[model samples]
Target: MAFGFTKIKSSPIAVDFGSDSIKVLQIVPTNPPQLIAAASVPIPDHARTDTISRMAFVSEALKNLLDTQPFKGKRAILSIPAFQTIVQHMAIPGNAQDNIEFEIGLNLQQRLNINPNRMIIRHFPCINVVKNGSTQQEIICIAAMKDIIMQYLELAAKCKLDVVGMHSEPVCMLKAFEQLQCPQDTSTAQCYIDIGSATTKVVIAHGSEMVFTKAIHAAGEQFNRQLSVKKKVAYCEARQARIAHAHGIDLEASLNNVLAQSQGGSSHVNDISAQAVIPMAKNEKTLGRREGDKDSIEQETIECLIDEVQMCLRHYHSLFPDKQVQKLIFLGGESNHTNVCQQIAQGVRIAAQLGDPFARLARIGLKNPPIGVDLDQPQPGWAVPMGLCMSEANI
Candidate 1:
């Protein structure tokens, strides 16, 4: 094929290998990024724990998705799942500033008892700290084993895809909300709480700079287990029930009944009854629990999650006493439950809203949008993949 003066550019495919599912996305690089194609495949229950099985499942899913979707180019960026990476805050001698990377590597080697050369390390310098009157530099360090990186690369190669960059979930998540950063007001801190399948990630940032991050053990899977135990049902059944509750099928049915009454010209039916399905204000102190067997179980599970998030916020406030998180932006698969999010916001005493990565996207003209994904509604689970699209190649 001959002859173009201008080089054609396409964003690298963003692959988010989540614990519960594998999400693949690509966007046209433009002023307001345009959605090109997206697809998601759930990880089978049998493959969830075993590494070999999981990898094999991912390989097959990725191959099918790429071959079927309208994704352009083969280059892709991957997000290392939160559970697979080591993220920590360390204090090093101020004198080590000149060779921070080397010092961090040595420190990690000593702490983890692993070969520094066998790990890929990255760090972000934070505010200095004084311990016993001696000044020290504080930094957030992220590391992943070389073997795990190679495994991902090999998977991509097998699928005939080129792996261009690798990023941690926290980094990719922050990148997804770049448009929300307020350059003029750098002091206003914001918190992002991503409730994923295995773990929850809490990221605190002041404007565009990330200051702190933590991964909580409590998340969606825990919720499912709690529901399973409470209901005396199989884990898979509980998971299905949880999904149905999140989608508000019961509420939808009630709304449909109200609409039917209004269409029959009943004077008793009012607009307020129809709008009652919307979640209450963030400041509400309690959720109006439904009266039934499922009510107590759902409430207890949400309370447990809120407790973990509250603890994380307290820890962050202790470290950065001067900076307070002004807002909470909830993302990830579990955030689809509006009632759960509202209760957590109430428990944390912070104004919060569900994060929508596609909110700022230009007129979406997706050719093959993933099943069950509605562009008109906020898709919080797509945050990591969308952020990857906005990311630059680390290589």
Candidate 2:
């Protein structure tokens, strides 16, 4: 008999097919997970509006990334973009527990006028309620088209990736913060706001159980349009300027001055302190053009988003009258803008902080980190991909 050691199981690659970009991540599941490989590619300007073109672009990008990166194993888990899935809270007959799927299918067919057999449906039981003098269970139903799931699977196959599991973005986002849950304190509710390029997702959790989720259409693309119109610049130019401003490049001179003072042992230098010292430029030239315009255009755009977020909170409050969200943790690509996050926090009137999904992870193989990822700063944008990494595989 030949004796051999069993091979240790490696984590499946976590892929997030975001509207703006496609992010791939793999981690070694150590005590504190360690980053093994990470890569991202932005969707082209021409492909953003076309579904087929976007999928083709993503397929080629994934193939190239996997070929170059040191990703282990061909097995992968991916997130279904929130926009592609239908999430709704519905009340069904109390006796439907044994046939919940059938009831949900019938309800969906009646309300949405779509064939439920063509969709992959899942539900989470919320609470029981008396409706029409009959007890009914309120459940959050998530449905994604079977064709869409097949498309994602086909995309993965094109990249030679074995799709092991798939999940919705909201679920993946919550998984990314699993380590932060306080089992001892179940009364305090928390809200996670993921402001992505296409949409902003609001997820509320009481203790470790998620209770509410909403997706807002107001997000980064709106900010870009606002900036483009206000600055009289091309859409692409406005996008670059918006990114530069978010990274504090527009206030370079002011930040340098603060840095000098900090080095002189004046005070601690952080994002908040730097913002305080550097009066946000009203209008300044950076990256060879005027990039600072947060006072008007940016403020208006963010205010629109804040209003939507407030509405989501109000809806959650109406559902759980006794529970109130005590904290707000901002995530997603657009959350990189501290000014925007600060405004939203102030507008929502909640104690808030930028969520760093990678905070507890030990970064490795980061000599050349992926694009849009700066390990030194809080990466609220990588929340979905990171969360996907922490999730369990189907097989």
Candidate 3:
């Protein structure tokens, strides 16, 4: 067994288990990577919070997707949810004549209050520091709860899938973006912000190697909820409004179009709701601007998001000042929102752009992608699964 960390020989499917949805992908390693197949499915409401419920839902969903989709592979590399993993940076004495595992176990036990015997610990070695003429290796530690690991294993077995290896979400995203596009100057650093439905993942990487990774509770859900509260509307309606606002869709124009259709005795009015027809409410507070502006809703919401990103950036720089981030890259479904992208760039004071993991890959149109997939444009959320497949395919 590879213990879910070692690479396997078979063509491994990349499965990203997220809080709201599951993304699956498989690719063939080529100069320009070939997309084998891809799928995304929403998580059921009953399985949102309970572990066993989630596992059961996911197992069933995986089996159904594989059976129906064009994906080919039995082995898989999974993305460990950021919330389930404990990540930290530590320095261990180098040039020592001692077993490294023993040192790591002792450090974790003393520092993190974690029992090494009950956790599967993995470390990625980073640049070494010279302290008092002694070599000290700086490494990033990732530890997962043993029971959670077992749940994933069981889920894989239930689907009759071989679990080849597992990696953290931040790592997978970094790998996928690096393969797609990265600064040619290895010395320069870049930041990756993956804004999922319920959580946001921040990663600072030098080239393909990550120096820092963190998970924040603020994400698309928070923004939507804020919009709902501020606008005094239902959540589903608020969600539609926020998405439309972010995409710069003129609500008034859309409403006019609908009215024109309705006047022609079309059934468009029946299909459109009052919430979607109305424009976003103004008079909401904004960041770095006067109150009651039309864009205030978006600006104010993104202010909270920017605060979290700044915290992560401060922490990253505190540890590695020399590796200052040169640019910001946004991933995930929320990254498609133009307003979010612009606000993040202005808030971070760094040039920002959306990441395309399929930038260098073969153009596989969105004619028949897996259910819940949006191939009309670049899907930055697929970065995790794509990166996992790249790792398995060794591309």
Candidate 4:
């Protein structure tokens, strides 16, 4: 029998696979870890419509991306979609890591309602755990379904990238945050939000450990769609207009015309408010009718968003009612959507004690030019990719 199996140090490359785009990042720690290389690849809607086609395009893009970077490492760390994986901390025996993985698989399989054998499990000894309604020393076992896990590895294989260790999106994101802003004081729970085109993820962390995470069903892309359809302009144009609107610019006047042109019961485009369109923003009809039906549309959007946020907070509260979330941070393109943060802050204020948590990185559109755009800092939507890369290596 082979004894003392050789331990292979996992040199995982982090590739962020998203609905609209994909990006790869690599970094090595040795006298201030420097960024090896970064690349952004876009996927068209047609290609993404089918799984097989999408995979093909991604495989091709990955090969090209790797060629450009010429990274020398084989082990790649990848970010799994938060919703697809189950993240929970259970008190398992502080025994061998392998044994704990086996037993934890049994418990989580029952808890997660999945076949026990189908899970890809990993755990690290936690300094403590909750027992008999009290906290005690134990291990933190993170389990993700194997089917989903293998898909990622397969994708890496297809791209000719090495897959070392799999990472939960939230935890990886927390590490990215620490990299961006060296954990201030290291004593408070910091909330991080990542808003993609369709899904938004909120993660709470202390140092590199993620204590809570949640995702919302809305993002900047949807808002752009609302603007694009109504305005008849391209999505890029609408996106620009929407960002301007987020910063409190009154695009209401011309935006009305865009609504007028698009206002047809035939399009099946639901226009909640004449306000969604500004007559001044578009010379032609760019927005739908919001003239008199303000109440229904306004209330519906705000309430839905509020309900979603509260649901996430309630979940975390159930775990530790007394644990106060210090700062609520926001991320993603939509985080810059005007008063979105204020709206979320107000919602949390009513239900729980949400400290002054801001998103990990908030993007402010159009800074001093010549500088081009300062997306490197928090004021821009720079944290997402950085977090995706920085998080892979963090403990």
In the range 252-357, model 2's lDDT, one tens digit per residue, is 4333444455358453323421221121222122111233535666777777888988988897887788888998888888876767777687788887777878
Q: What stretches of model 3 exceed 4 Å from their correct place?
A: 1-11, 95-100, 130-135, 180-185, 232-246, 250-301, 364-367, 393-395
Worst window of 10 by summed lDDT in candidate 4: 350-359
**Per-prediction CA RMSD (Å):** 6.5, 7.5, 8.1, 10.7
Give the Cα error of residue 180 in candidate 3, in Å.
Answer: 4.5
- Model 3 C-alpha lDDT per residue in residues 216-265, reported as the tens digit of each score: 77787777677667767656555555544444445444344444543584
Worst 10 residues of 1 by lDDT: 269-278
Assess candidate 4 and give its TM-score to the true structure: 0.63
lDDT of 4 at 40: 64
lDDT of 1 by residue, 1-395 (tens): 89877753878999998999999988876767888887888888889899999999999999988888888888999988887888877888888889888888888888888687988888987778788988898788988898988899899899988888989999888898886676566688888889888988888888877788878777888888876787576676566556656655554343444445436845232222112122335323233334462465567767777888787788677768888888888899888766677778878888777787877776556666565466656678888999999898986
lDDT of each: 0.78, 0.78, 0.71, 0.55
| Deviation of model 4 at 144, angstroms | 3.7
Report the lDDT of model 4 for residue 8: 34
| Count of clashes in candidate 1 | 0
Q: Per-residue lDDT tens digits of candidate 4, residues 165-280?
A: 56665665666546445454545555665666657776666666666665667665666676667657766556555554544444553354334544542312232222311212
TM-score of each: 0.85, 0.84, 0.78, 0.63
